[model samples]
Target chain A: MSTLIGVDWGTSSLRAARLDAAGEVLEERSLPRGILTVPAGGFPAVFDEACGDWMREPGALALLCGMAGSRQGWVEAPYAGCPAGFADVAAQLTWIEPGRIALVPGLTCHEHGVPDVMRGEETQVFGALELLGLQSALLVLPGTHSKWVRVIDGGIDRFATFMTGECYGLLRQHSILARMMPAGDGELDAAAFVQGVHHARRSGTLLHAAFSARTLALFERLAPAAVPSYLSGLVIGEELRVQDLRGTLSVAVIGAQALTCRYELALATLGVTVTRVGSQATWRGLRAIASTLQGTS
Target chain B: MSTLIGVDWGTSSLRAARLDAAGEVLEERSLPRGILTVPAGGFPAVFDEACGDWMREPGALALLCGMAGSRQGWVEAPYAGCPAGFADVAAQLTWIEPGRIALVPGLTCHEHGVPDVMRGEETQVFGALELLGLQSALLVLPGTHSKWVRVIDGGIDRFATFMTGECYGLLRQHSILARMMPAGDGELDAAAFVQGVHHARRSGTLLHAAFSARTLALFERLAPAAVPSYLSGLVIGEELRVQDLRGTLSVAVIGAQALTCRYELALATLGVTVTRVGSQATWRGLRAIASTLQGTS
Candidate 1:
């Protein structure tokens, strides 16, 4: 049995975890050195600084995911089309150091002639599946860009991406709606948020629904403090509104607590059960793929 | 008959018209002096700079609309509730001067307890009515905040606002989708724009539809020059998707050419007749309101 170094490198940050052959966490590190900050021809140095020691160990393999596989990252790893499984992803790795370090390819799924792509998230999806011990599940990973995924027979069948969080930040900070909101962040107001979620149901579309944040403030019906919560509810609710959650017994939500919690509440309101998976899914996902590469490496 | 000065002062720009008793445009001036750019206690001075000479004439009445009546503008004119007519708006005018000058009040409509407010658009709706000579009509004013107005019996019955333009700008310039797009403005690609509108119909929601801008570009299905047009189509299509345009015979689109032309195309694609009214509607609407103030002033 050999060690594995798992790297989840995204647009904004880089994270790494070292796992023993048993897939137990041994050591971990996180840094703001995301792929975007790395200058051209500098990913090798950054990679060395992050986990050169771990890679020096005999027969220790490294698997990198997320934007690190993007065209602008260390090396461009072509996307694996869905329905892809662990073996499918493992077989497509772009080896940085032959048989040692490789970039895990992202996933691309086509819908209505348009291509939807995901980098590190595909790994998180696989990790959630591994942790929850489910060969098939419905999953929603909410973030700057939220992905609603479908897993069938132990592989990713198809998925959709929604710019819910990015839209929220843009409206909350840059749009006219921001004028009525307070400068800094506010705690999530449950009641206001629920009201927002309900409003989204009746408001027809987000383009129209988002305007309520302003009117709600102007009429003194929503406090300055609760505007953010309400806005969050609108976007999150809209995200859920477009999803065909019927017959969806339970959805595995993989993301940070703050975001998944909002999805949990919205889904619960719609009578859908939710299971949460955290950042660990990224490691477990990388390890799962790395495990498949065992002996072959 | 008394002379009339019609001023449309909004957040980003100011325009004024000196009209004869017959509602003919005698003189006109446009400046970059929007309410947002005006210094504190500077509305009166800026107003003077734009149309002071026109106002100095004996018995010349001024009716200013748009953000000039907003809380942060010249004077905080209370919004007139729908179903409000010309008379209702005229009655609520915030008098900057007893009889010589006044700020036209905006209109507010309620839907399921949430409020939708509009300032300058109200004037444009009335002006569109005057130009089209229709006592009842459905009009859409496309801008930063697009308004879908319903006028019945020569009054604003009810309206809804969609953040279509603002959302398009935010996504095209600030979001991840921007990364795939070219810098600066691009010419409207009719084919790409139409494809986007059709795609929006199938995408279900703008949140999901917008991602296609990137995906379409990534797959090389959409060119960089056409990304903006595609995005614009997505938002505008979404805006129209939520509206109950079933019973409408024709929509009066009042806006600048670049915007109204797009709306014209989208609405036309939906098999709805579109009647475009230019910015002159503001002056015509104000003149119509001033005609009623003739003897009283």
Candidate 2:
């Protein structure tokens, strides 16, 4: 029988994991029922459609994370302030249903003058800390909005969000640069990407460096197929350059293989070590959150 | 009677000025017949519709500049190589109809590793120099693609193009940042904009700095209406930061008053002097080009 279910609900998609008393995944399912696609007051039904089949027994505690907790989400789960540990975050959990469905609160960093916020990445960040067993370290979670987190003594001290992936997406798909490239996604062109990184290392600004992706094509230095990868490298490299990476020996990259590898390549070029954490990190964190709820109940 | 017509036909709009034998504008007209909006093979008709009235007399020479001469434009006018002065550039003019209609060639920076092209700004740069009577100085034309032009000994020696304005438009209209701001073009908030420029002076990358526009809004430190101006500052600031501005006594900003003023504010903040040139720069450049053609013929 399923003792718990963990949900990672984001803007574009929803994923679920069914777990036993030990918090190991017994079965899993995913659907494209992201909050953006769901109509008003339709999330409960949509959630059931995505995971109803996996719920064999009656009362499996459901722990939800990500945008499902935002104001525009199903029910506003509110945000937990930063410098919070797993327990501090877990305690502030608000539920969609009084007992059946619990939504994990997102976090906000008040350390900086302007506060930065994240939804799903906080779980992955906490999980990364637990798996790596590090007291103070830098972590990077790359996506539409890439996050750079600082962890100290089992709590998230502070973090900054870089719209690297999102900016790259918008530029490639919508900007004038899109016209220069061929349709569909491109494979990683490591050399072209590294060339982009080298260009970013120069004193030129990003607004100026960004045009190099197109100029490189015009000059025949980079091919059309490699333009996306090169552009990706350009943005990612610039993102890394501005960070005070000095004295930071290594960075923990928590994300999938394809995306993280790009960051790994960029970091490697900068002479920093990297540790890759797979998507399972999110699930592991969810399972741990579920376990805590189980203990209290 | 009209002795000449200078047309600035770009991707989104077409503008023409009828000039007398003395290089004075006798009449002017503009239409939304930019190359991108016109149907394929419909340019001749569209051109006629825009300024056919000015072409009443058959001998009224038409000198077309900008995208109307691109490969996708009316006819492909190949680029003039850099270090090219008036004589070198004017020699490469390819005509639609000899002695009646001519398209000025654009410029390519073959000196730089990555070649950059500008279809319409060349005339503006030349005009700024002609109007100001400068033999050598730095020029910046802010637009979709902001160009930093260097004039030496009365010729465009070399220059760079930054996608500062275009990137800002794309991000504000199509990216996630759009959701954070109010609808329609926003009024400038000088304080918010200066705040963005100040952030650019920091070590954080543009990718990270860009998010501050949203974060500052989230924390209620900035008004939603001011976010656009703030973002504009962030981009223009980053664009200025990368360029080596030390010992450059003054920068000639050639564009509309509103746009040039923002650049002026940014440059002034960086402690550089700015010289503002108006829209007549393009028209003036076109007139000079006509005068040169008249002398040669």
Model 2 interface Cα RMSD in Å: 1.6
lDDT by residue for model 2 (B175-282), tens: 888999989756788988888887866634678788888778877788888998889888888788777787897999998888998998888897898999987777
TM-score of 2: 0.89
- A1-297: candidate 1 lDDT, tens digit per residue: 688899999998999989876656899999899998999999999998999999899988899999999888999999999999877987898999988999999999988768999998889998889899999999989998899999998899999999999999999888988888889866889888988998997777999999999988888999999999999999998988888877887899998898888888888888888899999898888888887776685
lDDT digits (tens) for residues A1-297 of candidate 2: 247788999998998988766556778888888889989999989888877766546776788899998777888887788888888887888977766788888988853366789998988887777777787889999988999998888888888888989889888998888998899766788988887887776635678788888777766778899998888888888888767788988999998899989988899898998999987777778777776765364
Superposed by TM-score, candidate 1 places the C-alpha of residue A59 at a distance from the truth, in angstroms, of 0.6
- Residues B46-150 of candidate 1: C-alpha lDDT, one tens digit per residue: 988998888888887899999999888989999999999978887777888988889889999999989999998988888888888999989999988899998
C-alpha RMSD of each candidate structure in angstroms: 1.5, 3.1
lDDT of residue A161 for candidate 2:
89
Q: Report the lDDT of model 2 for residue B4.
A: 78
lDDT of 1 at A207: 93
Q: In model 1, which runs have C-alpha deviations exceeding 4 angstroms?
A: none
